[model samples]
Target chain A: MSELAMHEIDRLKENLAERAAAEGLIDVSYRLVDSPVGQLMLAATGRGIVRVAFAAEDFDAVLDSLAEKVGVRVLHRAAPLDAAAMQLDEYFAHARTGFELNLDHRLSSGYRLEVQLALPRIEYGHTASYKAMAAVTGRPAAVRAVGTACATNPLPILVPCHRVLRSDGSLGGYLGGLDAKRALLSLEQDPFGN
Target chain B: MRLHGVKMKTNPPFELVVREHGPAVLRMCTALLRPGPDAQDAWSETFLAALRAYPGLEPGANVQAWLITIARRKAIDSLRARHPVPVDSLPEQAAPIDGFGPDGLFENAGLWDALGTLTELQRKVIGYHYLLGFPYAEIPGFLGGSAASLRRAAADGIKSLRKLLDVSEES
Candidate 1:
């Protein structure tokens, strides 16, 4: 193997990685980010951020889920996630109130979809009871269903599902785990048991 | 590892294919085409095409040989494009491929120079068998030569390259 051949191959890899998305080879692009909560996995489709998984959730398992649900054209590309990472950095630092990134919520659907869609309406730095979220989703009697939705929220913090709490304002179960839920609520200035 | 109702058989991912055989394809491309931008273009095009065609590629196929064959065709296309039949006046001196580019990719300039003089078939035969370490028997499927003939041609190519390069180094 000549040094020239090695150089050529490296250049080809760089070229491919740089241009794969534009070339339409990469369908789902993702990246790993560090946050106060933990390492977060950010994956995006052509439309927007599709999945945001917490560290407690194995990143590989999350990726495999994305592969199974989405297409297998997945790649660890950082270009699409660059703007999202900066926004999330501001978010974890408590400097940014809400994410401005477009999101694709195809990871969940039906009643769960309605609950997830209603979560962001809780507003940054605000907490909502499961009953309140259920009412907002036009399913006032589905408070328990709302809890299940918040519990199973695939996008978690990015979708702001962590803002859901009990009617008494007690910290509720979070899909990312209790500690992560508390950490996110704390990051948003939600005092415990308020 | 699957979704409900729709059963998809996952082929080995293309990334593995690239990591495994990319160097050989690049080297083979450089051997057949001129060792510069043209060869580099050929290499890129080969993989880009392979990536497009990968999903339908038959199961348990020889991936390396498949990639090499694609690179071979790409290199030939690039060579023809670069050496378009002389329109009015024949250009003086063949294309300059004696050394590495702005970056020092070639450790040996004499060998690079020697490679440029070999016929395209000789170059492919030698690149697949000698440079890539593919068995002679495996190469015959991608290339037209029998194992024995490819062995002979590769031997002759190496001998000529050694003689040409050794003489040039002394001068």
Candidate 2:
């Protein structure tokens, strides 16, 4: 603990802090998509998509939460999301229909999983009633349970929970709002028609 | 969001936790591995693994230390896979991260260099206590060492780092 030694530790701390900040910035980047709902920001690590936020969501809070959960400092930039955003853009444009990126599905499980798992089967230009999904999940009588699952789905669009409808063929519920679901269903009917 | 074993917090969203602490875990990976592209790979793998195992993370837990533990194991495995030597016989020099200045003493480089020379136990101790900003009390649970042992290890590691850097500067 000599003066020089202390100074060195101080220097190391400062250097470490600076490097951490720089690295965090370099590691995190976001892509914005003009979805039918609103602007969607996809935050990605070098490996894959880490977060997706709606336009009304608080960006800083979202970034902070992602960093804390993933145990990495989140750098806010417009770079890493280029690939994911592009894919989403294609999706929104109806040019591309599905995501090929690695997704961090840690935020979802249980009923959410059951619902998400059923989404792909809903097919393009097709929809299933909530009761139908419950039946598919072997909960043939748990139609209300299926509705809850759709409401809790973490990967909304990618999982295509919008395809779940009310037993009467009405749109049941969607995290992105019913209007967004309606728009998505419309787009699926006519990729270029939207 | 709502991880399986974790409780919902009215205080903050979980994504913020990932953003703030992710770099510390990455830094620990770089420190454990030799600097270079492989370190980056290890870091990526660590996060991917973390994402897969995220549901098990308990709320009010020390996420930074938890992540460091996982990353350390992954780094060791990555090192073992790339090298044919027995785990104990694996040379520190085998996975040298390219372009890293000696001991990471250079300001232009990342902190990984300085961390490379320490024993694995020391690295984890210091990583948990200092870089990731964990309290001394939490070190015992995260590292499975006694509180006193953890403190001593961190102190000794800091001393060792200073000495290592000193030697590097002189050379």
Candidate 3:
């Protein structure tokens, strides 16, 4: 009934993936990340983590957007994202307080990109007002711009954009919706916030 | 951003497609290419190539046929690069995969060695019929014969194989 042993063929596919990575044929590799917030689509270019998408963002649309913005060559190979996935799990477990991986903000631009760049500096378990975030981006008058920046933050949790709030100390708009905002903010305050 | 009504057709999840059809493609390659290492290389390249372009495949397309088409092309590539086909020897099968059936078509154990006695066309016809189960109606486009002739070709090929294999054992 069979002329081929599938296990050997599966081993060949693994070798093919590693060889593809080694040959630099991969433009962007991605994997779905499970977190306290929700399912996230994490994509990375050779540079770094390029995009982190909320489940509501529609994984297929996010991937298509990525294929358009990044190179068309993309695949689901979890190997490259293992370290980042581990850090995310630890962050959710309150065992970690910082993301040490490099980032690629190719999907963001102008004031938004500037805001995204400044987000990681907000510190863990702390909140910064929109005015404060705008100030950090050197556009103190761009408070609304700061809110837009947070709303459009591509790499949300990893970039610490959740730490930005309203000028009145209220949780502001989050790309992943308000409940996810609360979960993340509360998760940060836990002593497990290692 | 939400993309509810995008009108373009894209491939289904590429990983799912790969897992679902990989073994079938591998069997096709093994049946066509005969030699083990060559078959493995062809199988690897086939999926690697598929992964490269899978995102562009149409949603309603026949996935099995598409994969089989690619597998066949890779097998042909291996076939062409293979300098001289194995006219003798085991061609690396060594033992039949999953062992010979109870029907004694493979009782003597050197199936691949017997396969080496077959002509390339005979082997291809026999494999497409018996190993992969592609209907004879669809094979003439690739193998160049009517469905009846293709079936006869397969039958004749297997008859030649039994004679070749049985004589070897008696000797």
Q: Please, what are the lDDT tens digits per residue for candidate 3 over residues A56-156?
A: 88887787677666755666778888889999998888888998898888899998998888888888989899998878778889999888888988898
Worst window of 10 by summed lDDT in candidate 1 chain B = B94-103
Residue range with the least summed lDDT across 10 consecutive positions in model 2 chain B = B89-98
The per-prediction i-RMS, to one decimal, reads 3.0, 8.8, 3.8
Global lDDT scores for all candidate models: 0.71, 0.61, 0.72
lDDT of 3 at A179: 94
Query: Native contacts retained per candidate?
Result: 0.16, 0.04, 0.18
TM-score of each: 0.64, 0.46, 0.66
Question: Cα lDDT for residue B24, model 2?
Answer: 58
Candidate scoring better on TM-score of 1 and 3:
3
**Candidate structures ordered by TM-score, highest first:** 3, 1, 2
Best model per DockQ: 1
RMSD values for the candidates in order, in angstroms, are 10.5, 14.6, 10.6
- Model 1 clashing residue pairs (backbone): A4-B105
Superior by DockQ: candidate 2 or candidate 3:
3
Ranking by DockQ: 1, 3, 2
Q: Which stretches of candidate 1 lie over 4 Å from their true place?
A: A1-11, A166-172, A190-194, B1-40, B54-72, B75-124, B128-153, B156-171
lDDT top scorer: 3
Hey, what RMSD does candidate 2 come out at?
14.6
lDDT score, residue A112, model 3? 90
